[model samples]
Target: MPLIKNVIHRFHVKRPLTARERELRLDIRKPAGDAPHYQLSLIRLNSTFVECVDKWYAERGFGAMFGAAAFSAVAFGMWVLVTNIFKHWHPIGLFFLLVFPVLLAVTAYIFLCDAFTYTHYPIRFNRKNRQVYAFRPDGTVLKAPWDRVYWTILGHANPLGWLNVAGHVMDESGKTVLETFALSVNSTSKQGEVKLRNHFEFFRLYMQEGPAVALQRIQPVPLIMLPPIDRQKESWAFGWERITLTLNGSPLLQILAQVFFLPESLFRWIVMRTSKIPQWPQWVEDECRIEPDDPWRREPGYRDEEAIAAMQATAGARRNG
Candidate 1:
């Protein structure tokens, strides 16, 4: 479903990033406003690592299961055609017929895989070690030092590239990309690219500087919606939260949507029953372990401005006491 991540997997950086590539690389040392999409992807935030969702727009569709079924049907058709009708066709036709079943089956498997996998892939920005860990779609993880990874605003398809915040991890000697991951940002213009830049800059600054310094100029962070590990913990298989989130957290709109998207909600309920949850390896988890008195502790973006202010006041008072 996500073209960028798939495109990046096949890519290998042959040379060092040049000046033009660095044009969109805003100074992490400098501050900028944020795109709200960044906050939506946040899963966990702390001094050690800030885990956020990857492929930001991947979760909205309810038709992937259907797509898989469709591809399976096509594969079945090809299988029947090859075995019954086209056994004595031209070499090329026979080749296509023979190859198509496998190709379509592979495509169907891909769809089923995506449908049955985790609700979203997670990317962890390790503030403590200055590393980045991205959960790849193929059940692998992308690891790189935040500094060694070349960060840039990759505008795909001119002004049509909705998501553009991408980071490419390069090998030593500053050549050959090992892996890549896109940050959460949607863009349609130069201004939107700037917004995407700001979203990435927030992470860069947070990693280089601190959350306190990095969050200073950004927008109010959105409440994170993490995938539920236990089915019992989910409300309508997490559809209630998502439906509510559809209209900017409006209660009335959410109610209307529940009524409107009842079928989809039910489908999601069934689909989520089999959804996978990503788990980091022990070594990485060990590295990200928080000390008992880690002074860099910060709260997730789960409140509004006034509520955040009140929370800060309470925290300050507790610290003072």
Candidate 2:
């Protein structure tokens, strides 16, 4: 059976946002003078950390789950190699070959362990304040302030030297870090080595927070998969629906798509047809959903004059407020 597109539930109707609402949305209001209006939907909020984690993992498709399994398998292989080294299981002259394998195995195990631990912990995104707060699965808040966060930001492939990930931050000196890391932005570009230089330069601009210019862009984090056509029409999984979004600026929305395993309408048919894997009943087929025309992936090419003005006005209001 085919999977489907999810429909988004709108949090607020079409209306001018009040000052307080604008603060909460972290979006600027529409400027005057014939500017078009761009609508942004507030997807999910007010959920506990555990709830967010459950939702994130439960909706990922079979491929991601398989990927994790593959990692575990690699870890097991490493364990076997380590055991072989200690037990002298390899041929007497092959000990040197065993050295590399042993190290590789240890590395794989450590990586897999970290992945599991990261997933088990709950990560929460604050839509209003634009901050991510991660908690242990047991609900203990991790100890760290924004300025002192010692987390690693993953790097991505880049071409033409443009940074792929983007966001804004204010440093301790009150200077805003506008553009940081260009390698991520140029990830999809074909410029190759030259683009990496661009990325580094962009990073320099934001690293010092000299004068803020929104540079860190949020890229699509999914392992890329297309949904089956028929499922696109289903309603139960409204999270997959197509919606218009503004892309040109920084701090791209952290979109969480709930790819469907099967539309209820088709699941029955699947169950009746086959059972190849003995434990397949408990399995669901879905992927980490990516929003179409995601700002980080590509430009929307939207040059709406009205919407731009509105956005600028909103930005001005935010700065003044």
Candidate 3:
């Protein structure tokens, strides 16, 4: 969890795209609903921006806590080893004591920061400004132009059939992969690529064509008002996913998974209690302010017909008036 998110900046911007990152086109202008499977990551989708957490690790708490604990345990063990060697004033222990603890401390800190510091690292796609804003773990936000970003469905070989659908910030010449932020990376099966395609198409359509047009074009999964999450409040479900358990849809496996969910849910609750909700910079919020009659805004769980009709009518009335 923290291992990946904390080091996301390592690749840096202005570098060339990797061969793995270059594959797959997420062109929604190509088709409509090949296989709709959204991970239900939309925190809020209004006139100004569409907000979502990392879909791959939506159920973030337990895994993140485990990661932090693992690092901490190893760090502590290394310190004990260093002390055992140094109590008698061994010269060799000097470097080991100083370096090992320092490295472990830094590792522990990163994981702790991930598990207890912030609730979630949200990626916001602002349609009004045509910009993408990613909230980093280190109290800063990365902003990039929407059109200039390389949007695609990335297939990974290590995770074996796993795919990541995300947007990349390329170098000035538009060839190198400078920065990477994702929509979702949870899809694992080969068929997950198709589901991810449909999922990516949801946002692609929303960003490119607006919610009204997107509502008309989407299918299979059927777009609806996903209950908006509290941006400033942390809850037990804070880092959870909408549809959990990739147990091949087997009832027995799902039941077994549920048996383990008890402990998982407890860890999730513990993580949020120690963590704080993320707060975007005031300037960013100011830019995100909505108009009183903003047509692009709609409540979660709103029907497609109503979504299309409501926003269109509002826009139409404004144009007419």
Residue pairs whose backbone atoms clash in candidate 3: 13-178, 14-178, 16-176, 16-177, 17-177, 225-300, 225-301
Whose TM-score is greatest here?
3
Error (Å) of candidate 1 at residue 113 is 4.5
TM-score for each of the candidates: 0.66, 0.26, 0.71
lDDT of 1 by residue, 125-218 (tens): 9987888888776667778877677776665535545546778777776555556677754556665666676677668777887766655545
Quick one: ranking by lDDT, best first?
Answer: 3, 1, 2
- List the global CA lDDT of all models: 0.61, 0.28, 0.64
Give the TM-score (vs. native) of candidate 2: 0.26
Candidate with top lDDT is: 3
Error of 3 at 70 (Å): 3.6
> Deviation in angstroms for 267 in model 1?
5.6
User: In candidate 2, residue 238 scores what lDDT?
Assistant: 28
